[model samples]
Target chain A: DVKVTQSLRYLVKRTGEKVFLECVQDMDHENMFWYRQDPGLGLRLIYFSYDVKMKEKGDIPEGYSVSREKKERFSLILESASTNQTSMYLCASRSGGSYGYTFGSGTRLTVV
Target chain B: SQQGEEDPQALSIQEGENATMNCSYKTSINNLQWYRQNSGRGLVHLILIRSNEREKHSGRLRVTLDTSKKSSSLLITASRAADTASYFCATWANSGYALNFGKGTSLLVTP
Candidate 1:
């Protein structure tokens, strides 16, 4: 079975603190994504990377940035966490011919 | 922007009963997928129906797609308590790499 591992299941950070969420996939998938799931808003993409050292901004990438230093690892960075940034962060990965993405367990971040 | 919208924000049914949820999308898609999410877990992919396929089934799950209406339905027959979860529908939008997920329908099965 394919697995996506998220480094943190739950996190609490003070407002203005820098936050880092990490995701890793073992399937050798070429594509990786970071999204923030919010109530009523669904999953809004923050960033995605199709290859190591390459990243693309998604719809709601204003408060976020991403790093794909290695093929299996993708990281999401919150410059300065704020109350509004509190939400469940999801990571997904997909291969070239896969039907859909394989998702990580998710990281629920709370900014206070 | 989210492309899919699933109806019935919440549904409750007894075990062994069947539960159906509908999803509607706004634009053309290469394929549509169904996912199930437990209380605090990430979504698990359930089924996928491509643009050229009308219906597909896996175990007790049946999915139907209608391109003309831009709608799809998921039916879980003989539902169990373990099947109680949030169901979401996703589709590929203008961006070929990412998926646009719906708000989701929360289903509860009582034993």
Candidate 2:
């Protein structure tokens, strides 16, 4: 079975603090994505990387950035956490051009 | 911009009844997919229907797609309490490498 792992399941950070959310996939997938899920807004893509050192901005990438220094690992960085950034963050990966995604257990982040 | 919108924001039905959810999109898509997510967990893929196909079935699930209207529907027959989850419809557009998801329809199956 394919596995996607997130570094944390739940996290709490103070306002203006820098935060890092890590995701790792064991399937050697070429594509990795970061999305934020919120009530009534569904899942909004923050960023996605098709390969190491390459990243593309998604619809809601304003306050977020991504790093993919390795093929199996992807990280989401929040430069300065804020209250509005509190939400469920999900990581996903897929092989090649496949349309289906294997998701990691989400990390629920709360900025106090 | 989001490509799809699911109808009936929430649905409640008896355990043995059937549940149907509708999703409509704005542009041409390569495929439409349905996913189920429990309260706070990750989503699991349920079914995928391609644009060239009109209908498809898997076990007790049925999916239909209409390209002219750019809409799709997912139906679960003989629903069970264990099937209670939020259903999301996602569209893979021809222009992008990502799937655009809708606001999901929350389903509650009571026994």
Candidate 3:
């Protein structure tokens, strides 16, 4: 089975702090995505990368950015975390030919 | 933007009963997928149905898609206590590499 590992399970940060959430996939998948899941808003994509050194903004990308320096690793960065940014962060990866996504355990971040 | 909207925010059913969830989307899609997420966990892919296909089944789960109405339904027969989880419907558009997901329907199966 493909394994996606998130670096953190829970995090608490002060407002205006810079935070990083890391995700690494064991399988050599070409696509990686970062999404923030809120209570009633479902999952909103923050960023996605199809290849190393490539990235694209998703629906709600204003407060987030991503880095994909390697094919196996994708990172979501919050330049200046705010109280409203508190949410469950999920990372998902899909192979080039497959439509199904394998997700990491997820990180719940709270900005105070 | 959220392309899929699943109805009945919550559902409760007895064990051995069947559970059905409905989803509606706004635009043309390449495929529709159903996912299950246990509390405090990430989503696990359940099934996928292409736009050209009308229905598909895996195990005790049956999925039907109506492209004309841009709607889909997922039926899980013979529910068990372990089947309790939140189910979400996601859509893959013709042009994008990412999927749009719905809020999800929380299903509870009581033993």
Candidate 4:
């Protein structure tokens, strides 16, 4: 079975603080993604990495960035956290050209 | 910019009854996938149907795809209380590695 693990299940940060969410996958998948899920918006992509050091912006990438220094780890960074950034953040990974995906338990971020 | 939209945002059914949900996408897709998320948990991949295929099934779940209408349907037979969850439809676009997800349909199966 494939396992995707997130660094934190819940986090709280003050406004203007910096936050980091880490994700690791045991399957060595080539694609990693970060998404913020809201009540009515569904899972909107924030950023994705196809390979080490390669990143692309998704539909809602503002105030967020990603790092993929290694094949098994992907990190999402919030340069300056704001209250509006509070959300359920999910990390997902999939093998190259595969239809199935494995997702982390998700981090519920609270930016106060 | 959303790729898919699920119909009947929420549904409630008793145990042993069948639950059906529909999803419609806006653009051409390489494949469509269904995922289930329990309350406060990560999503679990349920099934996938390619654009060329019309229907697919696994165990008690059935999925149908209509490329011409750009829509798909998922049916869960003999649903139980444990089947309560939010079901989402995700689409893999022809060009990207990421899957675009719909808002999801929340299913409540009561005993």
Candidate 5:
């Protein structure tokens, strides 16, 4: 089965610390995305990469960055973690067509 | 920003009953999809209805799309206790493949 693996399931970070969330997919999909899910906000895209070394900002990219050095790995970085950034982070991967995204289990991050 | 709004923020139904949820979007869309997410896990894709299709069914799930009205509905018949989860509706944009999701409808199936 196709799988998207998130390195961490739960995390606690200090304010202003640099946080990294890693994601890897085995399907060799061209598109990988990072989204933060809040209670009422649903899922908002943080960043996405279509190919290696190519990245694009989404609706809520402030204070966040992404890296895609390899075809199957995509990473999300929090430049300076803040308390407001505490939420459930989800990683998803999809191909070029109209198929639905295969999402990872998600990482619940708490910034204190 | 979210492009779709799901009606009935919460619903509770007994087992063997049918549960229906509605979603309305603002603009034209290439397709609409339904996803189910457990309490704290990732979302599982349920079904997708294209712009050209009016209705489609998979197992006990039925999805209907009305492009002219910019609306869609998901119906799950003979619901079970394991069907308790949050259901979200996402729309594929006319120009891009990125999906814009709605807030979601929380459903509970009691024994």
Candidate 6:
């Protein structure tokens, strides 16, 4: 089956430390996204890349950045981790508007 | 910001019972989708209903959309213990390509 793979399942980072969450998809989809899920906020988009080297900021893009060096790999970076940024990070990939997204297992990050 | 809001944050039902969830969105949308996530796992797509279409079904799942009211409902017939999971509703608005998801409804199906 096709899949989206996240590099880490759980992470702990100190405040002010830079954190990286990696995602890779085997479906060769054109669109990849990173979203952070909090208890009451649902899933808020951080950043998304529709093509290699192209990125767009989403609703909650503050303190976050993204890289799409290749078609299959998309990465989310936390420039300076803060305690408020602690949440479950999810990565999703979609080919087009006709289909639903396939998401990675998610990375739960705790910033202390 | 989330576009959709799902009612009844949690639900508990016995096996073989029907479970229904409702979602309401703010703006014009191209489509509304339902997703299921097992504990600590990724979401799996359950169904999608477009703005123009009122109803759609896949196996035991039935979804209905009412664009006039900007709402949608998902009905899962015959719940099983394995059906215990969190269900989220996501909407793709006409102005954007990304989907805005709701906080989700946690359902517990007890055998």
The candidate that wins on lDDT is 3
Candidate 4 wrong stretches, greater than 4 Å: none
Q: Is candidate 1 or candidate 6 better by DockQ?
A: 6
Clashing pairs in 2: none
Q: What TM-score does each of the candidates earn? A: 0.98, 0.97, 0.98, 0.98, 0.97, 0.96
lDDT of 3 by residue, A4-99 (tens): 999799999999999999999999999999999999999999999999999999988998989999999999999999999999999999999999
lDDT of 1 by residue, A50-95 (tens): 8999998898999898999999999999999999999999999999
Model 4 chain B poorest ten-residue lDDT run: B92-101
Question: What is the two-chain DockQ of model 6?
Answer: 0.87
Q: Which candidate would rank higher by DockQ, 1 or 3?
A: 3
Error of 4 at A39 (Å): 0.5
lDDT of 6 by residue, A1-112 (tens): 9999997999999999999999999998999999999887789898888889989988889999999999999999999999999999999999964569999999999999
Cα error, residue B95 of model 1, in Å, equals: 1.3
Ten contiguous residues with the weakest lDDT in model 6 chain A: A93-102
DockQ, per model, reads: 0.84, 0.78, 0.92, 0.87, 0.74, 0.87
Error of 6 at A7 (Å): 2.3
Write the residue-wise lDDT of candidate 1 on B1-111 in tens digits: 899999988999999999999999999888999999998889999999999999999999999999999999999999999999999999986868889899999999999
Report clash pairs, candidate 5: none
lDDT of 2 by residue, B1-111 (tens): 678999999999999999999999998888899999998999888899999999999999999999999899999999999999999999864436777789999999999
Kindly list the per-residue Cα lDDT of model 5 for residues B16-92, writing each as its tens digit.
99999999999987778999999989889999888999999999999999888999999999999999999999986
User: lDDT tens string, model 3, B52-106?
Assistant: 9999999999999999999999999999999999999999744479999999999
Q: Show model 3 residue runs off by greater than 4 Å.
A: none
Whole-model lDDT values for every prediction:
0.94, 0.93, 0.95, 0.93, 0.91, 0.91
Off by more than 4 A, model 6: none
Candidate 5 structure, TM-score to reference: 0.97
* Shift of residue B70 alpha carbon in model 3, Å: 1.0
